[model samples]
Target: MKVEFFFDVGSPASYLAWTQLPKICAAKGAELVFRPMLLGAIFQATGNASPAAVPVKGRHSGIDLGRFAKRYGVPLVMNPHFPVNTLQLMRAVTGVQMHQPERFEHLLKTLFDALWIDALNLNEPALIGRTLIRAGFSIDEILALANSPDVKAQLRSTTDEALERGVFGAPTCFVGDQMFFGQDRLDFVEEALA
Candidate 1:
């Protein structure tokens, strides 16, 4: 079985879900297919803004995120700067996934840590290269891959496909024909595997 994970590096909830999903997939003997999609387009297509844009949801989301983090023992730092632009990070992720999927997972985890925990700005190429290098990839390779026209095109194509598929949010998981949304719904994913 395959679980197609639709995610973006910019989303805190997507970060949380991505961190936990590997273990879940492993236990279920399911293949986790990471599908990097542009969350911005997803939001725009659905005529929806981020949770932070909603007054009530934004306020409660923090508390909920903290609780979810604690429940899973995943660190959640709630960056003071709500939404950080992650276009570069997303492109870099596409590059990694194209060349080194295994390394991509580690790079992704570190990127998430930088985004949600350390609250580091990923817009700087130096920071992104450092993060990738620290995860055991050559900075030059990452830079080269990010500059590849193929990777750039793939990101755009994937984003467009995701929007057309009616995906309007980050952290959505598809198990065969069933669609499950949110990190909180991992239980449903587990049950589906059962």
Candidate 2:
């Protein structure tokens, strides 16, 4: 089975999905492809804002996310500022995937945790470098790729592709013709697998 996960670093829900759903897919022997998208574009098209922008939903989502985090033992650092720009982080993910797949996953998770859970600004080069190093990644390699024109192009291209594919939200899962939206819909994904 194949599962394509459309995500953005700025989405807390995407971070939650990233931390948890991989285990489920792996257990089913499914191939997981991470598709990084631009949340800003998606929101602009849909006339939507960050969950934090919506008072009620934002409060509720925080509660719900807390449950998932505690259940999965995933520490979430709720960024008080909300919606930090992730252009560099997204490009870095693609670059990391190219140079080191395993470490890429590790760094992605680390960065997500630090941003969503620790509320750190991932856009800063120094902070990003520190996160990578803390995750046991080669800072030099990551910074080199993060600055590479090719990686930047890949990130931009990938974002365009994601938009063209009709992805308008984070945590959108594509399983063949089935499109599952939000982390709450993972049960549907499991059912589809079964």
Candidate 3:
């Protein structure tokens, strides 16, 4: 089985999913495919509003996410800058996947940690550049690739494809034709994999 993970860095739940899915895939001997798509686009396409848009749900979600993080034994600090424009970050994901495939994993980890673990304001170009450099990526090269028309098109197509696949949210995992939404659904994911 191959697990297709559609995720965006801006979603805390996506980060929570990221913490566990890899290990599950590895243990199950399934190939893990990372699909980078913009959550904002998905929301627009599906007419889905963020869970955080509702104040009560947002507070409950924070506690729920923290519980999951504790269960997963991963660091989880909600970004103080709640709604980061991760356009460049998401673009960088596709760019690395396209150009520097070897660096994709490093890039993903760095960006995820910066936003969720370190809680950095990553939408700022300066911090993004510094973060990439520290992650052993060339700022100029990466930014160049990220800003390219091809990369932009790739992200757009991916987001469109996600919407077509009935994906209305991030951290969606597909086991063959079966779709599981949210990190909370990992048990079902594992069952389908089995």
The model with the greatest lDDT is 3
Q: Once superposed on the true structure, which residue ranges of model 1 sit more than 4 Å away at CA?
A: none
Candidate 2 lDDT, 55-142, residue by residue in tens: 9988988899888878778887678867688767777788887766777777777878788877887667788778777778787787
RMSD of each: 1.7, 2.1, 0.9
- Candidate 3 residue spans exceeding 4 A from truth: none
lDDT (tens digit, per residue) of candidate 3 on 79-161? 88887888889998999999989988888899899999999998788998888888888888888988999999999999999
Q: What is the lDDT of residue 76 in candidate 3?
A: 97
Higher-scoring candidate on lDDT, 1 or 2 = 1
lDDT comparing candidate 3 with the true structure: 0.91
So what's the TM-score on candidate 3?
Answer: 0.97
- lDDT of candidate 1 over 60-158, digit per residue (tens): 998898999999898888887668676667878999899888788788878888889897777677877777777787877777777799998998898
Order the numbered candidates by TM-score, best leading: 3, 1, 2
Best candidate per TM-score, number? Answer: 3
Candidate 2 runs further than 4 Å off: none
